[model samples]
Target chain A: MALDFTIIGYIAGTLTTFASLPQLIKSLKTKDMKGISPYFVMSFTTGLFLWLIYGLFRNDYPIIIFNIISLMFWIPLLYLSLMDNLKNKIKINIK
Target chain B: MALDFTIIGYIAGTLTTFASLPQLIKSLKTKDMKGISPYFVMSFTTGLFLWLIYGLFRNDYPIIIFNIISLMFWIPLLYLSLMDNLKNKIKINIK
Candidate 1:
């Protein structure tokens, strides 16, 4: 049987992109972003944004779709990370 | 000046793929995968494999390179999860 490679791309794209969700959920559940490194997230988000731009340039539907979904997940996590940092800063200032 | 989109792809690929390093290191340092979901890893691994296959079929070097690196981190993490589960099983059997 001939392999439909595009289907594989779709499945792979969805899995890798969505994998971040569990970590985001964990951070929310525990209200702890202690384990996640900001360096990784900042670099990862920048990379994803570039990928999204690339997708648009190529007009690749799957790339565009998946990259957008990834940004949706990552941006909020970044925001949470920022919020966490802000909280630390405020505590330090008060003390 | 015209933009070199390929460089953008490289940055994005490396960022997204290597983002797992911090998580992997955390697991190793703390010896805890309690926060990591096996379902996510399984699905993510499947996705990365397909992406690697797609890269090979398309002769896309960045895709191939990044996906392979991602698997490097993920496969070991998967093994750790399996080992953790096995240890849990042994504990139950002993009781």
Candidate 2:
């Protein structure tokens, strides 16, 4: 039963960690980020960073590993979203 | 020290759980989900559901509570995105 729960945790972690991947790929391909909120990207990345710290303090490998992976995806997403938003603002200003 | 770590955990959980809010609000206001990936929504929601189950099995209140809240935000987002996507497809078909 404990093993089963552990398996569930790992699976859940994997799913959540990679969840942002599709968005990242799609955003890169389409270059359309009008719908991706910059606030969401910022808060999520900050949360993941905190989770990594929490995991380190707790000495929980799963939390640390999964949050680390989540950060990898989210950080790049955050950067892209911010840059996109910046470009939009600049375009509007020029107009 | 332990209490500090617990605080970090809660803070992390809070940020992550509410991370989707801005996106949800933006999508609703703009009716623009073109940048939001359907795959991301589906996988993230599924992962949150699994995390809730894992929390139940492990008797982790924070995990259970946070994931439940996250689901509240995500499920609606998923529904809205799907509906928007369907509308777009229908429009394209008619064209």
Best by lDDT: 2
CA error at residue B85 for candidate 2, angstroms? 2.6
Docking class of 1: medium
Predicted chain B of candidate 1, TM-score versus the true chain B: 0.83
- Per-residue alpha-carbon lDDT of model 1 for B1-95, expressed as tens digits? 12666666667777888887876786667656554556666777878888999888877888899889989988887887677767878999999
Candidate number of the best DockQ: 2
The fnat of each candidate, in order, is 0.57, 0.81
Residue B63 Cα positional deviation in candidate 2, in Å, after optimal superposition: 0.5
Residue B23 miss distance in model 1 (angstroms) = 2.8
Model 1, position B87: C-alpha lDDT score: 80
TM-score of 1: 0.79
Residue B51 of model 2 has an lDDT of 98
- lDDT agreement with native, every candidate: 0.78, 0.90
**Model 2 chain A lDDT-worst window of ten:** A68-77
| Residue B11 error, candidate 2, Å | 0.9
